[model samples]
Every structure is written in structure tokens, then in C-alpha cells.
Target: MSDFATNARLATAALRDLFDPTPLQRNDHLSAQYDAEIWLKREDLAPVRSYKIRGAVNAMRKVRATNPAQQVFVCASAGNHAQGVAYACRHFGVQGTIFMPVTTPQQKIEKTRVFGGDSVDIVLTGDYFDQTLAAAQNFCTDQNAHFLSPFDDPDVIEGQASVAVEMLEQLGRAPDLVVLPVGGGGLASGVTAYMRAESPKTQFRFVEPVGGASLTAALAHDGPTTISRVNSFVDGAAVARLGVCTYDFLKWVDPAHVLLAPEDRICVTMLEMLNVEGIVLEPAGALSVDVLPELSDQIRGKAVVCVTSGGNFDFERLPEVKERAQRYSGLKKYFILRMPQRPGALREFLMMLGPDDDIARFEYLKKSARNFGSVLIGIETKSADNFRQLFDNMGKAGFSFRDITADEALAEFLV
Candidate 1:
């Protein structure tokens, strides 16, 4: 075996002291859909509900080994990374202080504390992630703590390689393709390195959230570059910039092999997994599989492995997820209706609805004049065609309306 692959195997074997390997299961549902043998590397089922624990545990192990006097580890993260570090801290009985943005979700904060128990202190600081990270790093320097980076460190990358190690052993051979989700690129770096030396024949497709296409941006520039803004909807995989170390390892990836997933389109995949396969996937976790439809022609009749990176989904987001999915599938729409200022106007509009159509929302904004007014309406139905029929009926009836479901500015202002 190659040296890096050998080292990765050793790292993985040592991890047995922590937890067993996550499952590599053949997903028949996805397989049939794409006409391929689709297997899922279920890192989402790991102890911290993500492969993050692998890197955290391994990084700490290396740190403690080289510096026997090291007792405290520090990190800044809003979700999985914090939990991973916290869990590792408790396991190793070491002191840890984690930093998170003030806007961090309560569930994530609680989960991190729960994993660390009394071994870690959760520090809520700053309103944004960049500011929070700065505070953590400065604090780490002041206290002489080992700052555990979520993805940049070499040891963390090695630890992430453990996933590939387990996959190779489980599969007995390399698959035709490996689909990976990239955020800061720690996991992708490790997996890609191992695959290069060990499973060289296997192809790769890297997925990034469309709004946070750091890796894609980096590859295009031939170096790491910061995006002006990033949408945080795919919180786990949304990064404004690729890590320098990760970019070094991944700089050679072809831009064509990188796929960008739209946030709303990702919601569709999340709903599919939840409803059809009974799998709960966070937006980032669903990224790899979300590309299947786009890559259908290329991946057909091949062996493909998609790594479902995490499942730390907050049930509170379920309603939002459903809404986005419905909208993306064309089954739901929001519109500004030009209603006649008559008492029976709503009744006339209601009569235009088809059998499967239901008015999910209806509110009169204000009366403009004695003869006219405006209403905000939301309609949901069984099929996209229902909206076409409804619109046709409205046009014939002379009731004008504008669909605001896809109007980003208007959706934010009103919806």
C-alpha cells in the first residue's frame, strides 16, 4: 500500500478505541432511480452524527501524543465540529473551551455541552462565525491552548482519511465513482488523497452548495479565493473561502467535476430522503445525492458511492424544508393578486381553484380605492400543472396576479 494509505489505515485502526466504523450501505432507492449501484457511506450515523468526530478524535490523539503536557483543546464551530471536539474532549478527559457565534442554534450549543459534559466550556461570542472564530483563536493564544481547526490541520485531514480506509475495507474494491460534499475541504482532502494512491481508478465528483461554492471558486482561480457572500442555508457545508491547506490538496480537481447544488433544489432531495427512504439528512448531508439528477447520464450503470456527511437536522426546520421543496417542485406558489374592491371578490377568486388546489394563504393587504385592492395569496396543489390551469382560469376571469414564490426580494419582504 502507499505510505499515505498505510498511515490512513493505522489512523483508522486506532480509532477503534473510540467508535466502530460507520456503515457503507447499498441504497436501493437511489440505485434504482439513477440506474446505478448506489451506496451511501453513512457518516451521518457516526457518534457525533457526522464524520467530524473522526478528525477531532484523531487530531486530539496526535496532539496529546506529541505534547504530553497538553491538556486543553479549543475550537470554534456552530454545529458538528463543535460537537465532535466536545465529544472527543470528554472521551479523553481533557479540558476544552469551544466558541460559537451568538446566533448559533440553541440545539447545537446544548448538544456540544452535552457531549463534553464538565470537560468543556461553551463560549458564546460574536454575532457572526468569522468574528467568533477570531475570538476563539485569540483566546487560544492567550491561554496557550491547542486550537483544533475544524478542517485545515494535517492531522485532522489524516483522521478524515479513516472514512476512506473503512470504505475500502468494506467494499473490497474501489467503486467506479465517489461523490463527496465539500465545505472547508478537510474530509475531501483526506478522502481524495487516499483514493488517489489506493483506489486510483475511481473517479470523483465534488459537490458544494451553490451559494457557497468555495472549492469551485478556488479551482477556477487556481488558488483559494474568498467569495463576497455565502448563503448559510447549507450551514454544514457553507464556507466563504476554502481552507489554505485543503485547497493545496484539492487544487488539481477539474472544475467540470465540481457540482453546485441550489439550496431550494437541495430541499427537494432532503424531503425525498425523509419521505421515501425515511432518512433524515441535513441540507449539507444531502448534497452529494442531490447531484444525481444532474449527473444521471454520466453515472448510469456504474458503481457510485455518495457520502452522507451529517444528520444533525433540527426538526424546527422541517416546515421550511417542506415549503422550499414544494416551491421547487412547482407544487406551491405565492402571488400578489389584484382583487376587485367588491365584497364578493374573494368568493369569485375561490371559485377559480381546481379540485386538487387549496388556498394555503389569503390576506387582504389594503383597499386602494372603492373599486380595487390587492391580496397576498399562497396556493398549493398536487401537481405543477394545477398552477398552469389555475393561472389560465384567472386570466380568463380578468383577475391579474404575479407569482412571488421565485421573486427573491419579494419573497423576503412579504413571504
Candidate 2:
């Protein structure tokens, strides 16, 4: 075996003492849909519901073996990584201090505390992840505690490679193609490295949220590059910049092989997996599967593996997810209408709707002059094409309206 494969095997063996290898199940639903042999590496089933625990456990193991005197571990995370580090700290019986952004959801904060138990101290600092990360690093230096990175560390990357080891063993063969989600690139880098060494025939496709395409940005620049802004909709994978160490291993990846899944489109995938397959995936967790449709032709009749990286979803976000899905599917739209003040004008406008069209929302803004009044209207239809017909009818009927469904600024204020 190659050196990387050997190391990954060792890491996989060590992890068995902590948790069993997560399932590598053939998903009949997705397979039939895509006409491919779709297997899912259920990293969501890991102890901390993410592949992150693998890295955290391995990093901790290596650290304590060399220095038994190391009693403290520290990290900064807004979600899964913090929980993974906390769980590892408790398992190792080491004291841990986790720094999280003040804007972090209470559900995540509570879960981190639960995993770490009395072994951890939760510190809510900074409004954003960068600030919290800086605080964690400075505090670790001041306290002489070992700071565990979410990604970017060599030991952490080695730990992540264990996923590939497990996948090969569970599947009894290397998959023809492996799809991975990209965030800080720890999991993707490790899996790619291990597979390159152990199963050179396997091809890889990387997925990232469109609003946070850090890996694509890195590939475009020939190195790691920071984005000016990132949409946090896919919180698990919305990394502003790819990690340096991760990019080192992934720098040669072809930019074309990296697919960008839109955040809104990802929400539709999340809801579909939940409703159709009864599989609940967080936005990042759904990344690999979200891109499956794009690869349908290429992967037809081939054995494919999709790593469902995490399942740390909060049920409270379901409404938001559904809303995004509706918007993306074009089944829902918002519009501002200029209604004539004539007594029968409202009735005339209502007559333009198709039988399948339903008014989801309607409100009238009064006008002092009485010639016309502003109306905020929302409509849901059975078919997306119905909107074109509805707009056409409205135009011929002399009703003036402005479609605000795609207007980000207007939607934020009114919708």
C-alpha cells in the first residue's frame, strides 16, 4: 500500500475504538432517479453527526500520545466542528474551551455544551467566525492550550482520510466516481489524497455552494483566495476562503470538475431528500446529492458514491428551507400592482387568474388621490409557466404590475 493509504488505514483502525464506521448504503431512490448505482457514505451517522469528529479524534489522539501532559484543547466554530471538538475533548477526558460567534444559533451552542459536558467551557465571543477564530487562537496561546483547527492541519487532514478507507472497505471496491462537498476542504482533500493513493482509478467531483465557492475561487487563482462576501445560507459549507493546507492537496483539481450548487437549489434538494427519501440533510450535507442531477448523463449505469457530510439541521429552519425551495421552483412569486380606483377594477384583475392559481397574500396600500393604489400580491401556481400566461393576460387587461420575486432588495423589505 502507498504511504498515504497505510496512514489512512491506521487512522480508520484507531477510530473503530471510538465509533463504528458510518454506513455506506446503496440508495435505491437516488439510484433509480439518476439511473446510476448511487451509494451514500453516511457521515451524518457519525458520533457528532459529521465527518468532523474523525479529524477531531485523530488530532487529539496524536497530540496526547506525544505529550501526555497536554490537558487542554481549544477551538472556534459556529456549528459542527465545535461539537466534534467538544465530543473528542470529553472522550479524551481533557478540558476544552470552545469559542463560537455570538450570532451562532442557540441550538448549536446547546449541542456543543451537551457533547462536551462538564469537560468544556463555552465562550460566545465575536459576531462572525473570523473574530471568534482570532479570539480562540490568542486565548490558546495565552493559556498554553492546544488549538484544534476545523481544517488546515496535517493531522486533521489525515484523520479525514479515514472516510475513504471506510468507504473502500464497506463497498468492497473503489467507486467509479466519488462526489464530495467542499467547505474548508478538509474532508475533500483527505478523501481525494487517500483515494489517489489506494484507488487511482476512482474519479472525483467536488461540490460547493454557489454563494460560497471557495474551492472554485482557489482553483481560479491557482492558490487559496478569500472572497469579499459569502452567503451563509449553506452554513455548513459557506467558507469564505479555502484552507492553505487543503488547497495544497487540491490545487491540481480541474475547475470544471468543481460544481457549484446554488443555495436556493440546495434547499430544494434538502426538502426532496426529507420528503421523498425520509433523509434529513443539512444544507452542506446535501451538496453532493444536490449536484447529482447535473451528472446524470455522465454517471448513468456507473457506481457513484456521494458523501452526505453532516446532518446537523435545526427543524426551526424548515420554513425557511421550504420558502427558498418555492422561490427556486418558480411556484411562488411576489408582485406590486397598481390597481385602478374604479369600483369594478379589483374584480376585473381577479378574473385574470387561472383555475390553478391561488392568492397566497394580498394587501392594499391606500392612496390619497384615489386614481390608483399600490397592492402587494403573492401568488402560487401549479405550474411555473402559468406565470407567463398570467402576466400576458394582465398586460392585455391594462393592469400595471412589477414582478419583485427576483428583486433581492425589494424582497428583503417587503417579502
lDDT of 1 by residue, 1-415 (tens): 7887888888898889888999999999999999999999999999999999999999999899999899989999999999999999999999999999999989999999999999999999999999999999999889999999999998899999999999988999999999999999999999999989998999999999989999988988888899999999999999999999999889889999999999999999999999999999999999999999999999899999999999999999999999999999999999999998878878988899999999898888876557777889999999999998899999999998998999999988888
Q: Count the backbone clashes (under 3 Å) in each candidate.
A: 0, 0
- Evaluate model 2: give its lDDT: 0.94
Candidate 2 per-residue C-alpha lDDT over 243-318 given as tens digits, one digit per residue, 9 for 90 to 100: 9999998998999999999998999999999999888899999999999999999999999999999999999999
Regions of model 1 farther than 4 Å from truth = none
Best by TM-score: 1
lDDT value, residue 293 of candidate 2: 91
Q: After superposition, how far is residue 78 of candidate 2 from its true place, in Å?
A: 0.7
> How does model 1 fare in lDDT?
0.94
